[model samples]
Target: MTDTRVAVIGGGVIGLSIAYHLAEAGVETTLLERGALGSGASRATADVVRSYFAGNPVSSALAVRSLEAYRAFPVRPGTDLPLRQVGYLVLFSAPEQVAAFEADLPAQRRAGVDVRLIGVEEARERNPLLGDLPLLAAAWSPQAYVSDTAAIVTAYAEAARRSGATLLTGRPVSRIDSAAGRVFTEDGGELTAEAVICAAGAWSPALVRGAGVDLPMTAPIEQELLVTDPLPPGTPEIPCTLHAASGLLSRTRGDRLLVGMGYPGPDREAWRREVAERFAETYPGLAELDLHPAVTGLRDASPDRRAFIGHLPGPPAFLYATGFSGHGLCNAPAAGELVRDLYLDQDPGIDMTAFAVGRQRTG
Candidate 1:
């Protein structure tokens, strides 16, 4: 019989982080994953970490804490958090776009996001790749950086194991008896715990449903394309650039530029073309570069675009840490810490009402 104090169902970065925090705090924790670690959203992350959320101060604060954790991540053999401090540049092409971002600048700044508004000329000076693309303004997050998602997940898993947490891979959890604090696996295996955390990302809603809890979550497919430069030396390294006019992104990793967007459409061909055309229009300097196949992943999105943390109503100790939208990578560290404090029944030092289960969605 396998029993632990807390059972975390998911092996993504968020789950691993939660297990690590809980176990490190002397909570008997066990994390079960259906496949290898980071096989889900973590594997398909855009690999960018930034603390600039337009209108969400809570998310920005979480991101700041997460970034701090990444900088202070324990370094050991096979567990290195490689960070590329290329920063992030958000371009605004329209007046309304600029105004909306400007309105949120104060909130983001108060949340410890080192962001500021810059004029088009200054923005172009920072990134010459903008070419002749018109820009109204830009949000510059100089401290934002990119890191490898798989590396962070593996590092946290190791840290959790070192802290005496049981990490199980290929253990597909079929269902959970939340009221009973028991989890059943597809291979006819069963385990019990005092609490169960449904951090399964896009696969969480179904699992929570079996426990009679209908999470307001949706699984949306998001994709990023890898564009390779034939000559690496000639490639101009650019910040993680996002065009606010359109949800298009481009950032550099070695010789390749990662371009991606979330296009809610039935035709994937149209999506790819849009990504290509947008990148070309935004960065005309590298328009002719080689475009590789698009990489895809699922996001567990909530209505407010913020995550739903904290435990559910009544009994069985069912805690939820899913619905991160697209901020999972940047917010996992703080999310883990928050979940840990919640499970321990201690103050997490952050505003719990912001991420409370039944709180009003202001955004």
Candidate 2:
């Protein structure tokens, strides 16, 4: 029997997932949160879940596994994750993106995601709004959809508690003492554990930097999914869309359409204007698009476009799981499970060499 107590810093979705899995394995765990659970990026998520990896097989594998886990979550005691399998459609305007995606198809299949390339006719039949636009081809993954991100966070936190883990809120962690396996909070309280997992998202750099680790991760403004007030009656289903060349993604929220793009540039005001100007050309059906207040978020971008989910070379207790490069939700379930394995010193049963070799490998 093991009596190791793990203290998890940052009670976001990733942290809560780790805590739940650790508790399930009978390892004592406690989670500390600066605010309520998932008040960070998790709350700001666009909620599109799919495994259509353009080229990276690691993230694709994680997305595939996480999809099944998400499907099984709501039935596992405490959850209102509201997972729906509407559809995930990726439109390729340029031939180069289509070629790249075609090359990645086999790898995506090997990673266990069954997506297929379909003509724009079928794509428009599914999402009707995409009729006669600059469309070369589209990848249609029928099983992908959006979920209530906040609900998922709540569910994970509840499941962790049900599994006999302690969760505290509104207390920020000041520093981490890796050598002594202790986490010092801003309130001057010390929490000790045999291991510590940092799932602090954008705020992760601070915690690890103090312990002499250099994370090449940056916090960028994510201008995602500005919702339209409410659509007219009989509006067609808004299939979850990823514009390949434009870096825009959107999903439907009942009578509203939530749209956003991945442009880490200046003011969101300019972005909104650009999107508004190009909205009708993209979706000519919607004669008038009235936008609502944006649900802004932040993304942790990595230099090498991958996440870190291993222990620091210098300290066994100082482990990390960040740098997801704006694809955190899609990778959460598998990433959480992998973090669980690392925390318990068990085999993750997957190749993590590339994932472990990202830019932020530090002590």
Candidate 3:
């Protein structure tokens, strides 16, 4: 049997953040990590923070709240978890796409997103690096920012530990006994708790299935990121930019340039080579870019690109907060708050009906 009152499966940012909040709320929480904390997708996150979603009110609200939390959160003495307001510039290459972005601006403004639509001349005026390209328009948001996700996870973990939470790393849970309120690890020891939260990122489905719960989640695609060698002189300290046409997001990290591209399905090997080739071919400025060894990490994607959060249908003591797709890092803080609220039988702050796991799939 477990000694703690709550057992949180997974010690990544989501799990750690939840554990920290729960522990602070005076609940006896134990976090289990298969590997070291922050070693999962959280570690590999590009740390882009923006609230310009495709007019999804819930997601836009959550992003806004999370951004505020990061800004208000005090850095842990010597850490860099505070928001770096580098802004985000989304570029459109086609006239139709520019019209779409222009349409999106009104809703984004209504959602309190500090965004502005700029033309190619203004875009070049702000960022002189757009070398005479045929850009149609750009969306600029000064509120967009980036942060060190690993450092944030570390701070949360440390804070949780200080708040009486037990963190066990390198311990993979082999099985979960929901009715018995116990978790059996691969190491042959079992821990029991009053409730269990499965926050396992990509492996969340496997864990929930182990508890006889068939959660609607899958690890379909893996994202790849490339970091260019130091930016050449004269390159302005540009904000994190996304090429809507190419589906690429590039940001400046100190001297190097961090670039990311999204591809469908799980083709890590293919993506790594393709990203390297595409980076050189598309961004001519990065033609000689030293493609820092590409890394692949899984994203827990659901049929709908939203998270599967809330109580599971089966065991009363079991809960789930997974299927964040690739937006978990940006939504971690608000998610943690929601998990804490759920555990305490309070409102989850946001109307989570749409994100409920019990919702019927349209297709």
Best by TM-score: 1
Model 2 C-alpha lDDT per residue in residues 71-151, reported as the tens digit of each score:
887576346567677788888888998898888888888989878999988877877776467898899887686787777
Count of backbone collisions within predicted model 3: 3
Q: Single out the weakest 10-residue window by summed lDDT for candidate 1.
A: 223-232
lDDT score, candidate 3: 0.76
| Candidate 2, backbone clash total | 2
Q: Which stretches of candidate 1 lie over 4 Å from their true place?
A: 75-80, 313-315, 358-363
What order do you get sorting by TM-score, best first? 1, 2, 3
Q: Model 3, stretches more than 4 Å misplaced?
A: 75-82, 99-110, 210-212, 263-273, 276-282, 312-316, 358-363
lDDT of 3 by residue, 156-257 (tens): 888899889999999998888787788889999888888899998888887787666677775456666778888887677778877776677777787887
Q: lDDT per prediction?
A: 0.82, 0.77, 0.76
Model 1 lDDT, residue 138, Cα: 91
Q: How far is candidate 2 from the true structure (C-alpha RMSD, Å)?
A: 2.9
Alpha-carbon deviation at 27 in model 3, angstroms: 0.5
Error of 1 at 264 (Å): 6.5
